[model samples]
Target chain A: MEKVILIKYGEIYLKGKNRKFFEKTLENNIKNALNEFNCVVSRIPGRYEVSGFDPKFSSKILSAVGKIAGVFSFSLASVVDSELEQIENISIVETEDLDGTFKVVTNRADKTFLKSSMEISRHIGGLILSKNKSLSVDIHEPEHILNIDVRENKKTYVYVSSNDHKGIGGMPVCSSGHGLILLSGGIDSPVAFFMMNKRGVKLHAIHFHSFPYTSNLAKEKVLDLAKILAPFNGGEIGVYLCNVAKVQEAVHENCNPDYMITILRRAMFKIAERLSKDKNYSMIVTGENLGQVASQTIESMTVVENVVESTPILRPLVAFDKTEIIDIARRIDTFETSIKPFEDCCTVFLPDSPVTKPRLEKVVFEEAKIDLEKIIDEAYAGIERIIIKS
Target chain B: MIYLDNAATTQCLDGVVDVMNNYLKHDYFNASSVYAPAVKVRRDVENARNELLDMVFASNHKLLFVSCATEANNTIFESATLRSGDKIIVSAGEHPSVFECAKQFQNNGVEVCVVDLLPSGEIDEEDFARKMDRRVKLVSVMMVSNETGAVNNIKRICKIAKKVNPRVLVATDGVQAFGKIDVCVDDLGVDFFVMSAHKIHGPKGIGALVYRKDIHISPLLWGGGQENGLRSGTENVAGIMGFFEAAKLSMKNQKSNFEKVQKIRDEFIDEFQNSGVKFSVNGNGSPFILSLSFDGIRGEVLLHALEEHEILVSTGSACSSKHSDNRILSAMGKSQAEVLGNVRISFNAHDAYDVKNIVKIFASTIEKLKG
Candidate 1:
């Protein structure tokens, strides 16, 4: 009566020579997710089976499996010996209370078995029909499909995959590269972190906080967002909180009022670029969308991003609409935390009329009134680094 | 730390903890259970109830011990059976517990009217008298404004409302006025008086709703017939005993504590005047609390600035600090800047901190933030 979890992966089977690399990353990621539980993940030829866990933790393990990238689907299954009688009994137990149309699916990897795959399915189908008079066989589109996976390990796993057990199908995290994500306590940035993480880019976060102008609750809100996005990034996200109040104050006092957002964004990007270089992250990620605000326009993006000379700026939601980004935010459970209305650094000294399109030289001239290097260095020296785990 | 946010909550007095432990450890019996110890516990709870009622000089009223002031306020409205087209009046400067309840009543087809507040944060008695009518079933006004410490003349208010419509029931939220000033519910002529324990150095999670005996109030919670069928569930024995101890101490030293707190408030104002920082007093009423406004500085920023030096204060009432807009300040005819720049510095009778050190911190922090 041992129960296990059966995990199936997609897209990785299409990977060419680096298939093992993806599989290993996915295996390590899943292991990290279920590290708190007492279980073992064993490879079973084109699938992975998690066993030796307490029965009470079966649902928890399946939930963790459901959050993992590169997984197509998973099931809570009962493991039995390869004998037909044992398989028949477990299949009956699986469909004991279930009624309606069902089809028995069998994959016989054990060649020594007497019956073929179709023969096993037909035999189990007839036996199940006789036992439950409420059920009939529907091979085309069955309400329930009882999958009996007979592996080469001399064990057969009988499991049922409910409609809610589908996995988040994407590339395995950390398989692509590492990124430094500019996370803000807003609706867009956390969703951007999720998008980059789904594409196999592991992320560390950086948030700019204005303390006296904003409160401690604003910083806590950003930390909560990081905690929510950590599970997709292998259960941990390193966040660096920079107090940019001094820089913002300098900009507010010295820079042109119309170019306030542009100069402030330039300063943030400069700090982000420096941090990414020091931390050895490959790229910088943001939740910037096209024409969303005055700071997200084509000219604004050009002027703001020009400060980073070496790193590539990745805007995953550049072409997305506001509603589309919000949908992803709601799905990832960061929408509630993001909409907390706590003021962040961006809202501290918002200009009444910020320039949407500015000349590069004028922007540079306005940014030079304040000692950008000195202020950014002072802000950078006071980084409060925290590691948030889900 | 110089904790000046006493109006939000005060630290539990030392003796209150011991009193609470006595009930929690030794006399831990369910008051409803049929046993000797349970009977003793029930009698102790009743004795505590009687002692609390006596503290307010409310011999003609009965007190129901509930969870907190918020629940007590809600129960006042819940106990009253008001139909559609019936009217209620609440002061514009009420606490959210009362203000939100008024809004809920208005949404449910009752005609809810709001009385105005003067710039001094006192209730406009003329406006209150004008709003009084036979259709108005209930009138809720706080004895002390939580944001500014402005004491409304509840005795005068009750007299005027009763003259207009003697059938009207009047409830006064006395959370800030309970221990800070002399409170005689009989003298005030209020049908319902709500008070909390935590604001007066007592234990939290316990409050009382003292109502006149002649009035009929239905139970909000229906259960095992506790609180004589007014409120349900087992009595909070430890909380009751702790509250009684705190209330006893506060009542015994009311006169001396009031003089000390008044002197401390005067010292704060005199020292600020000498510092030449240019600040305005928001309102004048109770000596236990003081609200100040600076011309260009944000109160929250000043609060954080002082917080770095281990001085804790509040921008407004702690419950409404999370909200950026100040409804009470706005209703008092203050400009948006004045509302945003207002900070409340409240005093506890038991505070032993030096006024000079706190004023020095305030001056230095304001200087730094002004840059």
Candidate 2:
């Protein structure tokens, strides 16, 4: 019997007019993912099916499918014609090894088929029971449920399980737009990268590595995190490490102690915005959880956000609680590397009490104490680009 | 590439690849099978084991060939039976395999204590004496430091440790010292020893744990009853053949290669010293390994800077380089600043590694970095 992989996506069904565009992009992505292998990815109405490859590489192909962004769930199924006899034969052959109670689920997209969905399910289920006399049926809670998805074009998919992998369950990356994501070696930033990536923005990640004060291990930790996030990117995710030590040093030396984090954040935004405009990025993404710390407060965030108004800064985790963000971090395999106690540039020369509520006008007045342009220019000059490919 | 990072791992010798291919392609047979061809492969594996034993003058020791040095280290710990009050003293600067394995014992129930290292990165004799007690069942130390290359006085340590308690078993990690220097398990008086093939000039994924015949050990991985029921897994036959070849070559060429590598290492050191760069040699270590530290420059940054000029070196121990900090350097009482600026440059006996060219690269790289 011939086997094929059935891919099901959830959100593109709601795209309406742009639905065709999303489907085309998904097809192109699946092709690129399986480029090394000899397989063909085709679209049938609302779903995509992968076929014509060696069955031995099914697990390998499924792993590649899971790395894709728009995937909801994928399944390996036996493909046959819409004829009832053919479906029954294949179902019996597939489920001959399985024991205990069982049921058959049928999704008949082709209305012109001779039998109704109920009739197909009962027919396939009865054939399976005939092959294995010891088995019975359970509708609500069966030990096994064989799913049969029938399309309008005389093609039918039969599998033991419908849901093979629950994907990242977001829009495909690079569909939204391009963004300059300011990544840090922390618990929240990598999660933010995934969150923004889920929303379909191709990320140009920038990490501010503070050497001498902070070690290269800190930068290595960020690179490791980015490697985990790279599988979801439509293209390779290359990170730029900018030495922002001079800017942070200037903030600590000249700015008021209460305004230390506040000013450092403003300087970072200025550099990120400059690079964003320089690189033609449409947005910014940060792992800033609202009110998680003094600098993340509504008033403090405003003072920092006010500086980089040219580009839209996307803080995906702003409304999320610490525990909620951590839940995602652990799921994505970034928690252990993120928690390594290597200090980044932000941790150096920290203030005793950073300003939780500072006016933009006063922040501007404090910023006049140092030359932002000169320090930012120096930091920008030292930007080292490292490409991380999955 | 001016690859001076031989201590990290070595490229296989010229004919070692062909030797490995011969076994892998033609003589592929499961040694456990009772067939004629299988018996021949088993004989070849046993011959390799015998050759390895003879190299270290360990004819009385029973050798169990494993996949990696880490696996060998873990197998020794698995072999030892301990009670709740039993103690194990491991050197603070042992590799992650031995260090973490000892910690696992501590977690289970054994009283594990860490003996300190001197500033030169050798296991401190006084600290070892202090940690020795009737409850201590095992004392583990490395024959040579992988990071700093400080050759430990294993003979003196075994003598001192035996005086305190004759029953305490001594195992030495011989991965770094085996091929680089002269090694004899009997002369060193170590009960158990671990060594890997790639550390010399053989293929990777091949290491052996040679223990005395009277000392009992169990298998960490239980599979087919191979390696005399001590380690039960399919023998890595091709790698063992490569290892046997590399062991023979290394033993035959140890003295000549030692003189040549030491001379090259000294020349490179003199070049750095003459260039007026603010650098400090970390430890009086093995002549083949040199650990240098610049006053204010980060070792990682310097390593990358040198890599731009095609010189490959290392910053700290590669195994735990991604870990937050250097536990070994800190344990040796090196200050935070010195530890941060450390880089290890190791040499091997290869025709491509010219002493004059490597010395010149070191001088130019240091000059560019300093300027």
Which of the numbered candidates is closest to the native, going by highest lDDT? 1
RMSD of each: 25.5, 23.7
iRMSD for every model: 28.3, 27.5
Candidate 2 lDDT score at position B243: 92
For the candidates in turn, chain A alone yields TM-scores of 0.95, 0.94
Weakest 10 consecutive residues, lDDT, candidate 2 chain A? A54-63
Interface RMSD of 1: 28.3
Candidate 2, A1-390: lDDT as tens digits: 688888998787789888888888888878887876699899997789999986545655776788788888888889998787888888887787666788988898998998889999998888787789867999989988899899976899888963356777778777888898889989999899888877777898999866767775577668778877787776478798888778677777887867877887887888889889989999988999888988888998899999886799889999998999999987766886698777888888778777788999888988899998898888888888889866
Best by TM-score: 2
* lDDT of every predicted structure (CA atoms): 0.88, 0.82
The local distance difference test score of model 1 is 0.88
